[model samples]
Target: MHAHTATRPVALVTGAGRTSNIAAATARTLAAHGWDVAFTYYRPYDARMPWGAEEGAARALHAAITEYGARALGVEADLADPQAPARLMDTVADRLGPATALVLAHCESVDSGLLDTTPESFDRHFAVNTRAAWLLIREYALRLKAPHGAGRIIALTSDHTAHNLPYGASKGALDRITLAAATELAHLGVSANALNPGPVDTGWMSAEHARQLRSATPLGRLGTPQDCAHLIEFLCSARGGWVNGQLITSNGGLA
Candidate 1:
């Protein structure tokens, strides 16, 4: 039941939904770099808000990655659950062996304004965006202490955190957690970091929002999933060994 053949390295990516999302791009990028990929998708019953109609998008992403001759497994889990991270790690270990790299890409909130955000919204964001990420990193660190070389843990954050957005504040907390975990895990051969993508052209942004963001960016264009994916790929590679406890922003100087 090993997810990949004994030869390939394993990578786990969370929040890999269908819509050309950052997680999807990261998965493909990792596969291209020769790592078997396993990603998580929230079940339809568990989706709290309308995530658009990208049916079977996760499956398509899995197929695309596997097409590159690497193994891909998609698991459906409720990230809001406190135990989800442990369960996810267990699933990955059972199906794909010990993961050498972990990507925490799951997010559950999209509230635009602070006034409109609810307590439930805050809790959900913290649970999925911050807490689960911490748990994943902890589990990965515990498993990597043996003589298998150092592992990588990359979590996604947002420029909104710098802009004082409520959801972004939660991400800020997640960033702090990453820093603390990185210091603790460094001794165990695990490097933890956060990737903050400024504005991406995901369908999540409205036309007006997209225009404003693009105009504000010095690059005159919004970020793309591939942009984030490339950085993630580099960080997960041997070359990124020295990068730990850093918050690398991938924005086009929009901040």
Candidate 2:
């Protein structure tokens, strides 16, 4: 189940919904490092978020990945659909090969508080942020090629709460479900972990929010998509093979 023609390993990255999203950064980084990439995007979801909609974001990212000279495939699928993950894997295997790594960075959320949140909204959030993520990891583990330590899974999470109730709760579920992948897929040579990149300025953070975050963080800088891509690169690398099942907070010492 490796690359179709035995080329460099392929990485299937979710949440690469836009050109500037974290998944895009991770895909670009992996491509630069000689890994082929397959990205999934949910355009309707991104369109509803404050970041606004994107036209051909997936195609643009695919072009960028190929610029690194690595084969790239972009699929416009909604992970919330449940069946999307399997189709994504199949497409990758058929087009780019087996994915050596899976990065879940897609999220669905709004600033609805507990009192304001409707049942439909809450369920929609979980459908994408939690349920879809769980399914993707399970499929990734099952499709992984042999050699126990070759599979890598990284789930992105957030620590923010308050008005972000649905996001907070669903991501918490995402963290726990993904952590189990380490033990559940360990015998199969897969390592799974979660990363919380708090307060990334992905167009939602207002200027005031950025100032507050920078002032509070020891590094005095906002977390960037590159920051996330850098950490993910390590986890997928051989040196990070032993790191598993833990929720690592890579927020530049946000205190």
Candidate 3:
């Protein structure tokens, strides 16, 4: 049953497991701008992190989207699986129609240096952050039914590689994959770009760490999920279609 009659564009945002995260913010912002939003989350990943899973966050996000007069679907997806990307794309298409915007905010980030990083951990990071992104983009481009120049792909990336080798390396690969979509998917008129939103504390930072970062940033505060969400809202808009194929840093000039 197709719920989309093209009355509003659809957006597929991954990693929206937590209501306070960037992906959740992006989903709500897009919905407010007349988009039907479908988001994926893996609670197991959040459970493994220092910030344990937020129970019922996805339900709350769906309710929020509906409050904005937009349809919403939440799926529990483990992007580490090679098959998950295609399944995700298909599920979103079946429910809300083909997504015009694909926001990849999912990641496998476990802090380990070159010596401490295990082979299994490295492989998992690449599987989730790099290969999954590539596969998702491929699925999206192939299944795209949106009109020409209407497709958008936005990937969130980071450059923190000192103590976090595998995560950063895989993200570097993701950046390349996203940028390649800009040229390769040109035939389909899909504009792709990577965005680095530096140090937005979504409950992972110590108070001291947050204060240090706040003082370091030229803007005298940490970046917020809304900061990234607003920029992504623009990137997914028709007006932002021209600003493609670039790696944009939306950090508040942290030095």
Say which prediction, candidate 1 or candidate 3, comes out ahead on lDDT: 3
lDDT of 3 by residue, 1-255 (tens): 112234888999999989999999999999998899999999999999999999999999999999988999999999989999999999999999889999999999999998999999999999999999999999999999888888999999998899999999999999999999999999999999999999997888999999999999999999999999999999998879998899999899999
Best by TM-score: 3
Per-model TM-score, in order, reads 0.90, 0.95, 0.97
Point to the candidate with the largest lDDT. Answer: 3
- lDDT for 239 (candidate 3): 78
Ranking by lDDT: 3, 2, 1
The collision pairs in model 2 are 148-189
Q: Give the Cα error of residue 85 in candidate 2, in Å.
A: 1.5
Question: How high is the CA lDDT of each candidate model?
Answer: 0.80, 0.86, 0.93
Cα-based lDDT at residue 12, candidate 1: 92
Candidate 1 lDDT tens digits, 6-51: 4667899988876488989999988988898999887552254565
RMSD (Cα, Å) of model 3? 2.5
The ten-residue window of minimal lDDT in model 1 covers 141-150
Q: State which candidate, 1 or 2, has the greater lDDT.
A: 2
| Rank by TM-score (best first) | 3, 2, 1
